[model samples]
Target: MDRRHKPSNILPPGEKLPAATVDIDEKRQTVSATLPNGDTVEVLLYGATVTSWKNGGGKTENVWVSEKAIWDGSKPVRGGIPIVFPNFGPPIKDHATSALPQHGFARNVRWEFLGSEKSESGTSSVKLDFGLYSSALPAKFREAWPLDFGLVYSVTLSEEGLRTIMTVRNEGSSAFEFQFLLHTYLRVNDISQTTINGLGSETYIDKVLNATKHEQTTPSLSITGEVDRAYIGVKQDTTSVLEGGSPRFDVIRDNLSDTVVWNPWIEKAKGMGDFAPQDGYKNMLCVEVGAIDGWQKLEGGDAWEGGQLIKSLL
Candidate 1:
């Protein structure tokens, strides 16, 4: 009963307007929406990230970096979650050099419509803020990496769900390294009936290959197949649950140490094509809320923020 995208005037491809409809209600449930139509549907509660679970879908939503680590949303923006800053995954570029759009273009550009608010406890949420200052970069992006940044994307569609917050500002002048991740894409009803509860004794970093390789300590959890790993140095509150067979999801994260649970599930969504209900991935699951090492250096007037707030414990 959740599916929207009936409003159009133009803009579609990569998108840049012409897809509106957002509503949220918090009285006793039964009211939630996020209709941007590229596909961020009725949401139902807190289905925040629709795609870009970093790399697993590699370039579908384009936004996974590698000057060091922590960046995953690779390509068309085929989802609802992507915010990797400073140095989440790969990319230091000898302090700053390599720039081929390796996850640092502010979710691939087009965000500015700051006009919606109500959520500080005000209930019925709706706050939208998107900015990528620095004279609106795009001249091949200031000759490939020149610093001066500002990306603030705050999307809140309540009923106790879909609260994505990301703020990163290092408006230029020295100190500016990066790395961050929130690449979530969850929506399941199957996927082996899901199962992921707070990384039992965490510490992971095995991007399918090498990163000083590490991952062995296990307890009990399930996904299905072709999953990637990246749980490292985590400890604090930490609560992860994606159950199944009855609409369950509890992904709570704060300050986040690191965590990335993936699912290629079925031939990687058949090479993707807007990733329709195309098996949906047997349903879905991609619990990720990470932070890499130290990296996130922001000096110039300083400004670094974090995001991802989901809800729906039913």
Candidate 2:
């Protein structure tokens, strides 16, 4: 029996229960949802980045945000789940996204709030939709990419987990290639006590080791130092993050074939200006799910979709 589907106590006569609520803060450009059970999720319009998710009656924070994250849209939010689209990492020379900045411009621009609704799944869930079109891009980015595209990002929060889906529509007359990643920063008590279960038999590109290809021999991986590896061709659809030998988060993917595990450790943590408290790396680990090992080509007038569901196992 799924815990989320368990029957609730019957309401007394003439008594009403609180319903889920969604709030939009126009001044801050943020949207937030709160469940009757006290779980909450918040998103920033800038990049449609999810800044916080608190479950367990608002006592536990599953998502992590940098203390120094710029909230005024001066820079990309340093943590939470930032969308990486069009390209991943540094752009390749001669590529269509070559002129775009690292991780593309999706995280640097503001997205329009499409709307919110109660999920049709018969579960107590709230869904928020955001859209970003090529025309909405700044002139500099529009000129750099020069492709007509539309992206619809949907974030749904329920007792099951936080599910995010991105649908890309190529509105132009020609096919275009792009890479996408959901950069999720998950909170943890300690880095040394955390382990990632899955991708044991997959090959990974160790970005910290000059992009060397290596086979993952351990069934469970731990981050000891500055770790940055992209596990390619992941055979499992679900990966679990364990803390102190207990399951903490389960990342379920759809159409996402790769997983990137990263932690800046010491030196790299101190290097980033946005990463505050210097040692904040010990409290956060990035288990990014995406289809970025290679490009996904979308034909004109066609749409492609991919996403991940981050379930809090706590």
193-295: candidate 2 lDDT, tens digit per residue: 9999987888999999999999999899998999999999898888899999999999988777999999999999888999987999999999999989879
Worst 10 residues of 1 by lDDT: 1-10
Runs of candidate 2 with Cα error greater than 4 angstroms are 1-18
**Residue pairs that clash (backbone atoms under 3 angstroms), model 2:** none
- Tell how far residue 239 is off in model 1, in angstroms: 7.4
Best by lDDT: 2
lDDT of 2 at 217: 93
Candidate 1: misplaced stretches above 4 Å?
A: 1-84, 89-113, 117-123, 130-132, 135-150, 165-178, 182-203, 206-211, 216-229, 232-249, 252-309, 312-314
lDDT for each of the candidates?
0.53, 0.90
User: Which has the greatest TM-score?
Assistant: 2
Whole-model lDDT, model 2: 0.90
Q: Each candidate's root-mean-square deviation in Å?
A: 17.1, 4.7
Q: Provide the global lDDT of candidate 1 against the true structure.
A: 0.53
